[model samples]
Target: MSSAEKDKSPTKEVDTDELYQKTKDEIRPKLEYLRSVDDYCTSEAYEAISLIRETCKSLGRSKEKISKRVVDFMLEKGLAKLIVKILRSLVKRNDKSAYESRAKTHSVAKILQSNVKSREKKKVRIELVKCGIAYPLLQDLGACDPNTEDPRQRIRIITDLFSLRLLTEYDNPSVIPIYRSAKAVDILMKFAQVEYAIIQVRSLMLLATIVNEEESSRIVASGECILTFVEMLQKAIDSKDHHYLFDIKIDEENEKEFFMTGNRLTEGLNNLASNDANKSAIIQYGGVATLTSILRSQTSKGEKQEAIEALWKLSFVESNVEVILAHLNFDTAALEELKKMKSSDDSKLRDASTGLLHQLEMINIHDEPPEEKGSSDDQCHDPPPSYEETMSGMNVMISYNWDHQERAIQIRDKLKQKGFNVWMDVDKMRGNILKAMADGVEKADAILMCFSRKYKGSACCQAEANYAFKLRKPIIPVKVEQDYDADGWVGIVTGMDMYISAYSDAVMEKNWSQLFGELESIEKKD
Candidate 1:
């Protein structure tokens, strides 16, 4: 207490914590409601936030401290409209660039820039999203145009909110409404193309979440969102940037960035393609191949599952059957991965594997050894005769699906070698299919029906059979699949006629010989 000691008095630090604690007690009672961020926009949050802002200023706190306290109050009340309002106020008029000069910088920008490395800021961002800030933030992201004043600051605020949500509020339901909002998809899509990896991936992440639900899948599929999603996947796949989920090399250092973009983009594509409407567009855009590449990436198990599922949906289209089956070829690494999955301990993997295998087989892809080497001396190697022979009078019109065209072609070559003209449209179908079928049947002596499940399933093939029958052309039913219910058009045309069944080699040869004899009998009848 001496004059010398007093002269050397130490300045005491004002306890912001005690100040905050006491303020909380006093403020809580005086304030009517101290709940969500929305309270800031409400009549109740106004006085409390202003009080905290003033007290922090009066406490001789730094600008950063005042901002922190204001944020704390906003965060405590759920950081709702009041934060966005304050943030909007901080944005400089007509400035929208991240690299904008500091002279024009807004206080909100300063706070966000300061907190860019702040953990508390991170948590507050998430809390803000939980308080339903994502909706308005997303609206700004989508709604703002190049002409909007403070566009850059607005974008930063919107993106910052998303960055925080991605870090913390990943599973929140509030995200669904964000994309469902007007122009939200466009805004997200634009951001998704940003040069920055963080911005692009975070935008894609939000998109994936929005499309995760079946009902919202349509909204995500609207306009170029589907195409953009697919293009993102195509770029990732083209770059070969996915990390296999169960692989040994999944370390953070090597593939973290690429895998992040690839995984999120793939997830979004899968979710959007879950809607059947999107599948046709996807297949049209060659997205099936891109998706196959995703599976080939051997990315995460979840990502691969999503690709498999999207492919499964694409496979349902008969026109897409070839594309899907092509991806399962033996040379492609994806097939082996799928085959390995068939015996996996994971039930989902095993089931998806089994289903895909069955689907491929149904699409005419089968597991088999290399085709047996033909004998060196076989005279069947002899070529067919001149075109005059084919144009000569009677021919055998074989009705079949393109799936079994190889077999149909083999039989045509055999008939041609045997001096019988065989008119079979294997790969080419010119002009109107029905008209072509009618003309082909009209010029034929008899129609050799390559009857099977696929033949039954094809409308065009059935059309030929029906037309040939109506033309009074002798219908010869060749059963390719044993016990195949030939009970439809085949039964109607042949009328319980004895047919050649070729389910195996012995049966196939026997049927082939019988078919030739039947042709000879028909030749005699002619």
Candidate 2:
């Protein structure tokens, strides 16, 4: 090779053999120092031992040989101080590699393995993986000869792992394998202590993700775990500790996924909610209180939104709403908090409050006395007005694009010609346009939303549409542009239908007349 080629070539490869020797030289004293401690086999102490063992393994040294060195080192260095120093250092670094190395230690796996049996090892494996431990090490731990003959010992190991904050990862699919095992399920159901708030919350979220609804239902119905999880969330919400909230940012992004799981859990719980005993149990366990607290807290906007949606789902059970309404009434702080939300600039907050108000209205309406059955004279009450008469008296609110003002004016003229009261911005008070539109919407018999591609992008229009939908008024969607599509707004109204009207002055003039005729037809039907 020429001089340039030589310069470009890599330097002599470091001998793997020499590197292994060098690593052992550096770690030997540290290992010796760690083993001298009295609680040397304790979880944290074992974690330090595991780290040294893993470092040796990474350097291609045999664990058996390193284990001998560690024993020798512990004999010489006073194990307790060495282990404490190592753990403290690793904790300070807060490095991912250190965590990984700590996870892979044979000592750690041995400690985990000794607590469980062969048949029930999967739970230990899951618990380890959740705790940010390496899955391969967990697998190796599972393959190890377990100390106990009793199968329940395995469940105890799993519970211990959970209590140790070992299973914390929410995105890992490896957990599914453990959840699928009956032994693992039993252990999860019976495990009395949860190590960390994150673990409990993640487990609840994970239970929501199980594809099998029956299995999911069983897990949620376990009583012990569900109640425990609810209590955990309640404590976190009440304490207002963000650390305990765990992955709040990520949860916000995957909220819909959580909701899908939560909805299933809710369905299972709703059956329980039907029973007065179960309902009280749920309330006493802090489910309703926790949910309300979350709504009132300084949580992520997404969490607040999800909590509202969850409350709505829970409200389907008749008893659930009564509980929520009671909370809303007596919890002055919570009531004030929600009332403050109504004035928020966020459209979502406004929409949620509107939905809640509508629900309250529905509940009240259901409690009202039924109308008298005899109505022959009531039916003939001055002979109900004809469709044209109704149209003439009814007010129609129009939401149209500013760029299409002339068309809106023309349409307003046509409606007025039919003797109908029309409230378009052109004819209404100029200041506080939104307030004026809201007032018109409240009083109008119907709202005519002029739909176009531009309409969807308008915040004002969306707010108005949301308000109209909340009011349960008939919204007649008139499509003026070919680009306009009604599919997006379909969820807002089932009675609302799309109508196409021409944009040209002459054609629009003709369509406006037809539009009134259609309105007259609807009025007659009503």
Clashes of each: 9, 13
lDDT of 2 at 412: 67
Candidate 2 per-residue C-alpha lDDT over 251-357 given as tens digits, one digit per residue, 9 for 90 to 100: 33441111113322333333233222333446656677766776667666555545554454455345667888887777777667665554444545544444454
Clashing pairs in 1: 36-77, 37-77, 37-78, 37-79, 37-80, 94-150, 96-152, 244-298, 245-299
Q: What's the TM for model 2? A: 0.34
Off by over 4 Å in 1: 1-93, 96-130, 146-171, 178-228, 238-260, 358-526
How far off is model 1, as Cα RMSD? 23.1
Candidate lDDT scores, in order, read 0.53, 0.48
Task: Provide the TM-score for each candidate, comma-separated.
Answer: 0.40, 0.34
lDDT of 1 by residue, 1-526 (tens): 8999997999887676776566567655533343334323334444555554444334333344544664566456533434455444323333322223111222232243234324345555455554454444554455444223343433453445344335333233334454455445556666655544344545655554443223334443444445555665666655654431211222454321113456666665654544445566777776777777665574677767667666654554567778787756733787777776554444344444545555455421223221123421221222221232553356777877665676777777878887787777653542223444556787788788888644553434544676677678888887765535455345666675677776556777766778888888887899
lDDT of 2 at 13: 63
